[model samples]
Structure formats: C-alpha cells, structure tokens
Target: MSRKLDPRVVRTRQMLRDALVELIHEQGYEKITVQDITSRATLNRATFYLHYRDKLDLLYQSSKEIVKDLTECIDLSFEEDKEFDFLSDKPHIVFIRLFEQVSQNSNLYKVFLTEKNMPHFTSRIKDVLVDFILKGINHVQPDDQLLTVPREIAVRYFAAAFLEVIVWWLEKDMPYAPKYMAGLLMRIAIKGPYVNNPF
Candidate 1:
C-alpha cells in the first residue's frame, strides 16, 4: 500500500508551485530564482530547500505532477467497463475530464504551454498525449485496412493537433466551456476537416 503524504507537505508544495507559476507569468522562467519563489510563496529559503533543490527542480517536479494527474484522468476514460464511442455524438468522458482539468489549472498550463523557455515541459505534455493516443488505438482496434498512413504518423498527427488546440484554447482565454470544447474535438476527430468532401 502507498503511504499518504502529510497535509502540511502537500500545502507547502502547492504554495511553491503556485508561486513559481505566478513568477513565470509576471516575469519569465529564466528570470525567476529560488529566493524569488520563496518570497512569493511567503515561505523562507529553508522551507523551500526542504522540498526543492532549486527553481528548476521545482518547475520539473511541478510539471511532472501535472502530467501525472493528466495521465490519471485520461486513464479513467479507458477503464475496461466504460464503452467510449468516438463516433458517437456525445463527447468522450476523457476529453471532458481532460479539458476540465486544463481549465481548472489554466494558469499553470498557460505558463507551461506559452513560455518560450519551457520547451521541455511542453514536449512532455505532447508525449503524454501521444501515449494516450497510442493506448486508445490499441484499445479500439480499428481496422488496419482503414488506415492509409503509418500508425506512428497518425498518432503524432492527432497528438500534435490536440496539443495545439489546447494551446490555442488557453491563449484565447478559453472562450468556450470545457464540455463544448470536448464535443467539438470529438466531432472533429470523428469526421475530419472535409467531412462532406471527397479526399
């Protein structure tokens, strides 16, 4: 069995993560320092050091945590008993949950996705999406004859498009609700851009 984390430890880590995110928005990642994070978090250097070695370590751990949460959310959509029909009019639960998660954590995502200095973090998100797509393809077991292009190419294409759409949605201040976005993505995924036209 897994050990439960102390509530105090969780709160301190969240504060540090929030401070780092705020600092990244106000200035940028490269300009922020360990002292800057502690100051913003209203904690001292010793408390910060107790959890993270430096700002980079904090950023990395925070990013990984976010990605892990996302993976868990996505994994729920693939539960064996849940029948997810991509072609159905209804949006997949995974997309709804994924978008909701992103909306809830918009600030952190905006910093990770838009900041030029955090390409590695952005790439990590993309990698998660790619893995998600691969699992989906494996689970669904679509006809091989239907796929004209290589599976790897198709997976990357969908993953990149999904990631870009997220960046666009966040950049635009999330004009649409998460459920609406989820439905839209489901529609697009089921029927490509030229739904009525011949390829």
Candidate 2:
C-alpha cells in the first residue's frame, strides 16, 4: 500500500541522482558540495533542501533506491515457496539475475562497489546480501537439523566472498560476460574450492 509520487518529483529526484553521480566521479564524494550538485542538476539550493536534508542524505537516498530495486528484482526473479528447491537450478538463476542487474547498472555498481571511499555504501550492500544469504541457508537446511558451522558465519563467508568478487569484476571493468561469470559462480557454489583435496 504505497502512494504514488508526483511525476515531477520523480523526475527531479532522478536529475539530482544523476548530478550527484557525475559529481562523485569528477571529484569524489567527500569533495562534492550541495552547491555543486544543485548547479549540476539545474536546481537551486532551496529546491535541493526541500527534497534532501543534506548531501549525505541525498547520497543515502540514491544508494537506498539502487539497493531496493536490486532486492526486489532478485526476490521477484527467485521467489521461494514450500516446493522451492535451493539445490536445484534456482540458485543459479538467482545468481544470473544478480549479475544481469549489476551489468545493467554498471556505472552505479562501479561507483559503489569499487570506490574505496564509499564504505557506507559497501556495508549497506553487504547487510542486504547477508540477510538474503541467511534466508538461503535456512531454505537449504532441514528444520530439525542443526548446522555444524554457525549460520551467521556461513552466511557472512559467502556474502563477503560474493561482494569481493563483485568488486574485482567491477574494478577490472567486467572482463567476462555476465553469463560466463554466473556459470563460474554456480560451479563454485556447488563444488566449492578443492583446496583440501590432494593433488
């Protein structure tokens, strides 16, 4: 039950987001000021203030919108039911959808994932992933059985690894296609690294 926003508000917000992103790239987030964003967006200081309390508020809003869209896309693409099987192709499909979403928003992903200065953005994303991973773990585990390793540890391990790989891919400008990366991720998820096996 969400109310629709005015079209003008939506347009103005998008303009501000685009301006902020452009400014961030040019001078980094720390150096960008409210005046810079307002000028870039063709809006006045009062208008910017009306929509956002400050520059950091604008940044949080932008980051939240991106994360919310990503979460909804992933959840809708990989809905879980009583019959849903985690060990089947569903996880792979989810991973593929994730990579596709990231590829679609490569500019924003590059800025948020690889930018060392944006720790808050990175932490927020990790928090989202950890929640999803915890749900995934429970989905895969039996109701009566307990995991040998703590659930939080396992969730954090996979979440951190996934984020690290994402950062690497973004930093390298996505040398591989999304499909190829998805395949590799699926294989690793199933077989894991063979580090302990004898050569």
Candidate 3:
C-alpha cells in the first residue's frame, strides 16, 4: 500500500542526514545553519530546500527515521504468541537487539542522548521506551497483588533507569559489548541493584 521512494531522493536525504550528524559533532545543533548542512553534504541551498523547510525540519525528519528503525528492531524481536520471561538468566532477544541497534548507531545516539541541549529528542526516546514497557507489561500479565508499587510508576521508573544506563554506556565509550550489556540490563531489571549480591 505504501509508495516506493525514489532511490535518488533516499540518497539525497541520507547525505543531508549525514551532513547534519557531522555538523552537530563539529560545532553543535544550535549553531548549525541550513547552509552548513548543504555545504557539508556537497549540495546546494535549492536542493536542500526541496527536501526540508529548514534545519529543524531536517532534524525532526532524520530523528523520526532513527526512531522508526529502533522501533522496528524491537518489534522484530517480539514473538506474538510466545511470552517473554523476565526472571530467566538469559538475556532477552529484545534487549540484545535494542543494544545492537544503539551500538550500530552509536554516533547518532551519543549526540542525541548525551547532549543536554537536546532534551526534546531525549524525551522522545523515553516516550518510546515507556510505550514499549507498558505494552510488555500488558503482554506478560503479571498479577497485580504481587506488585507493591503502582504499575505506571514502576513502568516509568524502569524506563528512566534503562535510558540513563544507556546514556552512561554511551558517554563512557561503551566499554561493554552489546550482548554483555544486554545481559547486564536483564539482570538489573530482574533483581534491581541486587543482581549479583544477596542480602
């Protein structure tokens, strides 16, 4: 049902996105102009305008693409009929794929996640995680009697903690491998701070 995008258009947009990433790294998002992006992309102002209204428009669209890719990664990892086990020692495929997605796009993630100036993008990422967690909780159907805290609060807490840890991993140059990080996240989610130690 969806129309196919022209290859030329796709290539041009990728160039613009790449240029934006490079410019953001060199200077910062606030200082980048449309001219800077076009120049970096080796394209002209007219061509740039044909695709986007302005730098912000380009940023929003590029970010949407990244978010879409991440969503797809998570979606693909979920098996519709199979329930995911949270207490298992093994890392979930969803977490593994999520980490792999971030690792593959580390540069873009570092810019988006660690940049204090880009709170909008950071919040967008959190929203995605929150939505995923809510859906996951519904799918798992845990008994309400066992939960000491409110479901919404727990969901938000987990989402925020997961996002912060990812930001830390990125800022620290990802010393751990994606698979290892995935397992660590699973352990933390299952046992909280008591993952390896027992009281």
The models' CA-based lDDT, in order, is: 0.88, 0.80, 0.85
What's the distance in Å from true for residue 81, model 2?
7.1
By lDDT, the better pick of 2 and 3 is: 3
Per-residue lDDT value at 32 in model 1: 90
Q: Which stretches of candidate 1 lie over 4 Å from their true place?
A: 77-83
Q: Estimate, for each residue in 12-31, the C-alpha lDDT of model 3 and write its tens digit.
A: 99999989988898898999
Worst 10 residues of 3 by lDDT: 76-85
Q: What is the lDDT of residue 179 in candidate 3?
A: 90
Strongest candidate by TM-score: 1
lDDT string, candidate 2, 49-74, tens digits: 99999999998999999998778766
Candidates 2 and 3 compared by TM-score, better number: 3
Model 3 residue 149 lDDT score: 80
* Candidate order (TM-score): 1, 3, 2
Runs of candidate 3 exceeding 4 Å displacement:
76-85, 195-198
Q: Cα miss at 104, model 1 (Å)?
A: 1.6
lDDT of 1 by residue, 1-199 (tens): 9899999999999999999999999999889999999999999999999998888899999999999898888876465635667677788777898899999999999989999999988999999999888777666656666777777888899899999999999999999999999888878866776658794
lDDT value, residue 118 of candidate 2: 86
